[model samples]
Target: MSTDVLIVGAGPTGLALGIDLARRGVDALVVERAGELFPGSRGKGIQPRTMEVFDDLGVLDAIHAAGGGYPVGMIWQDGQRVGEHRMFDPVEPTEDSPYDAPWMVPQWRTQRILFDRLEELDGKVAFGLEAVGLEQDEDGVTVRLATGGSVRARYVVAADGGRSAVRRSLGIGMTGETVDPNPTLVADARITGLDRDNWHIFPPRGEGDGFLAVCPLAGTEDFQVTAQFPEGSSVDLSLEGVRKVVAARSHLAPEDVTEVRWASDFRPRAALADRFRDGRVFLAGDAAHIHSPAGGQGLNTSVQDAYNLGWKLGAVLRDGVDEALLETYEEERRPIAADMLGLSTSVHRGEVRRGEATRQLGLGYRESSLTAETRQAPATLRAGDRAPDGTLGGVRLFDAFRGPHWTLLAVGAEAPELPGSVRVIRGPAQESYGKGLFLVRPDGYVGWAGDTADGLPRYLARAGL
Candidate 1:
């Protein structure tokens, strides 16, 4: 089969990229090695910045319906509820930042929502098709599948997990360190003795013991069970083993865990690929970087990777933009991934608290080559910063930034006539933006900011606007 883009793995990254490309009318296909979607509550925390991305992708309403707020953590000792611990620093929602906190939705459910959205956009995913080998020239990429088939595409994206076959096939190396040597077991099960009010935590009773946490998976009846084991200890994923662990660690009886739906084991680690791009194929998500699940950064960062690349791929494949635009993907995302990896490691080692840093709203590409800050004096909201959401001239900023198009926000300044493709919103001087002309990129960052439209035309031509 021939296509514009071929994506490997049907996780959040691939599915999100598929949806974005489909909306932009780019012909893309996602291929997954597994026959079905993942069925675990592995990556459960969706950061606020990712929530904004979901809003632009048209899945925010469904996500809100399918998830709930993170509950307070309840400390348990000797079968008594001791004290309450807040998992994250409390932040109130504001007009500038709508999604101020993380939302709790299982990774499986999030992927399902993204898949459904992709299907709605007329995108397709081929299951059980593993990318065994690939070759790329100056024009396109040719991928050989294990199922006795091949695909040719203008570009290929590796959204596969940490042990990515595509990354390995490209001979790329990853630099990483073991965040924790102890093994951890995470499972989803139906329990009878636990209430869904708060996350229950059980501290280790002895030196060699491990910590255990049982969190009720919001929007579902199952509770996710996580347990830590000593270094060099093997983890048991069987139902009986889970029952034994639960009974021994907490006040609940062995019979409390009635059914085990899905379970897995892993050791915490942080790794980053040396490069994100190799010829016509690019690595994204866990394919490019691996993170400890402590701050829930892995999946959030992975989804953003797809979001960052989707519009660039659309511009190149559909809008005939310069191929050099693709080079900015790694230039922008790699540093963010590296920083998030550090945040995750810090959260895992108790060196940092899950506060504003974990929200991810502050991440931006100020230092990227694509950003143009032409203003003599930039404000807090400047080029390369995320455009805040608020009302301007009775039009909601997010509503103006929704579609796959750039936005020109003339805040307390005269508007300029632009191409029909660019959406324009003008309003009196707002506190957030001050007085300036902000050119918002398709991915919701300020591409250029100036006091007037003096350099707007040149910038527009450069961005293919």
Candidate 2:
């Protein structure tokens, strides 16, 4: 079989990419090694920036319906509630930024939502097909599957997890340190004797004990149980083992944990690939970077990776843009990934709080080669910054930015004559954007900004607009 793009792994990253590409009319196939989608509450926090990406992908409504806001944390001592702790700093939604806090959706449920959207867009995913080996040339990539079948494509994306087989096949090296040497056990289970309103936290009572946290999984009856073990200790993921851990840590009895749905174990660590691209194959999500789950940056960063690449791939494959446009994928995302890695590590080590930075709305590509800031001094918004959401001339900025197209925003500035392909929104009251003409990329960043429309056309032609 063959296609324009071959995406490996059906996790949130691959599925989100599939949805974006499908809506853009890009012919792409998502292949997963497992027979079905992942079934865990791992990587459950959906950051605000990702919420915006979901909105553009047409899955925001469903995602909001399938998840709920994270609850406050309730600390327990001697089986009695002591104090309340907020997982994240509270921020109200503003007109410029809609989603203020993280939403809670199990990784499995998020992937399912993305998969359904992909299917709705006529996208395809072939299960039980694992990429074992791959050979790519100047034209395309041919992947050898473990099932003895081969698939070819113009490009391949490895959205596989941290121990990505495709990443290993490419011989790419990961550089980082273990945030914590202690092992951690994470599980989803149905339990009684606990209210679903607060996340229960159990601090170590004595020496050799570990911290335990049981958070109610939003939009579901199951609760995710996480426990830290001593260094050099192996974690137990069995149902009985989970029950024992719960009973030992919290006041609940072993019988309270009635059913264990899914469980796994891991050690907290962070790593990033030396490069994101290798010939025709590219690494994305955990394939390119690994993060400690502290600030919930791994999955959010991964999905955004797909969002960043989807439009570029669409531009080159379907919009006749220069293939050199593809080079920006690494040039732009690698640094962002590296920054997120540091943030996640800081959060893991208690050096940073999960606040504004964790929301990811402030991230941008001002230094990217694709960005052109021609204005003498930009105001609230600038080139390489994320275009804020607000109503301008009765048209919502997000509404205008939606879909696989570039947008020109003439804010308190005279509009220019441009190709009909670029959607234009003109308004004089958009406070988020001062008096300037902004060219918004398909990925929602302002690629070029100027005091007027003087260099706009040239910037467009340079960006293959």
Candidate 3:
């Protein structure tokens, strides 16, 4: 009937936020319309950055035990491996970095992991519960559930999918056009012919006539297969359709790719909401932005959204900061979401161009305000940047130190002990800010990184950290 925070949708973002808040001793609830957990692994394969976040959450080990990691992902043309490089392997630790190659797991599996963590903190997700109506006042949010019950919360976070009931309840509008009419055939099933170890990305090869990506699911023998739909033709999305996709793409027939587990037709779009928050209500994950799944960044972006907002919400409730601080959710994340939508759109466009640009320029958040404070000049990566991990120094800080605390990444021994809200860690001395001061948020993100600790206590005072 009441909670400190109420979250809609039990997917990755909601689950992660709920667990984070619960761990910090907040009363949180997650509501979902489906009676059962999400059935399949629609958005699996955690990215390197997100794995770092998981490490900070203190659950990386559980995820690692249950997840898998591959060394390389390559581009293929009709089963012939072409463009090749290592994106996941020899995961070396670089300056101020943490974690290794990303731990690959299914979307549902991730939710289960987060839910398990939440349960440990007196939290559980309610499936088949829907927020049909939402009303807000100065004190709290009033949510009308479909089951004829109601809930009151200091704040509500909408992690619902693209068709969000919470967003509609407010007057916020989702602005942007569909990137294209392109629909892709996606499956969470098994295939016989392809090698399971490597990420096999097929480009317009043979009868497939488009791209196909076959990746091994973490901790399971099952392999995830994805193939782009032909320019005009669409699958029926029935069990037979799932078989047909594999049959048409791979060297084998329908019988070759059996088990026929689960399948769907995903119409990937590039769209973002005009706003992410309204009074006591906020939008996150697919509720805030929608984009193509080309680079597997959709879920990562969503989870990061939760990581960014969870601490703010918890901090506000815990120690009493300005509710207005929540407005930064849009100011900070909207651009990131917008950038992802545009980047994914460009990647899909490059699929037709056969251009090398999209394949090379992975999305880098170097321009973020978190990194901007440490910006002298941008290297391949920078302070506010999504810190890239490569073998550097004798230690691995990023992956190893990921946890639910602010990290102060000192390039050298000059790492100062600024206690209140800033976290500090040490990395190799390779560039500027080696002895400088920087702060990493609890979610493995950079917030205030600078050469001096000046105005830092003030920054934390304002964030209520």
Best by lDDT: 1
Sort the predicted structures by lDDT, highest score first: 1, 2, 3
Angstrom error of the Cα, residue 249, model 1: value is 0.5
Tens digits of lDDT, candidate 2, 295-349: 9999999999999999999999998989898999999999999999999999999
Better of 1 and 2 by lDDT: 1
Per-model tally of clashing residue pairs: 0, 0, 21
Question: Which should have the higher lDDT, number 2 or number 3?
Answer: 2
| CA deviation > 4 Å runs, candidate 3 | 70-92, 98-103, 198-214, 231-234, 351-432, 449-453
Q: Tell me which of candidates 1 and 3 scores higher on lDDT.
A: 1
TM-score of 3: 0.82
Local distance difference test, candidate 2: 0.94
Deviation in Å, model 2, residue 99 alpha carbon: 0.6
- Give the per-residue lDDT digits (tens) of candidate 1, residues 1-465: 999999999999999999999999999999999999999999999999999999999999999999999999999999999999998878999999999999999999999999999999999999999999898899999999998889999999999999999999999999999999999999999999888999999999889999999999999999999999999988889999999999999999999999999999999999999999998899999999999999999999999999999999999989888999999999999999999999999999999999898999999999998899988888898799999999999999999999899999999988889999999998899988998899999999999899989989998998787
Ranking by TM-score: 1, 2, 3
TM-score of each candidate structure, all chains considered together: 0.99, 0.99, 0.82
- TM-score (C-alpha) between model 1 and the true structure: 0.99
Span of ten consecutive residues with least summed lDDT in model 1? 373-382
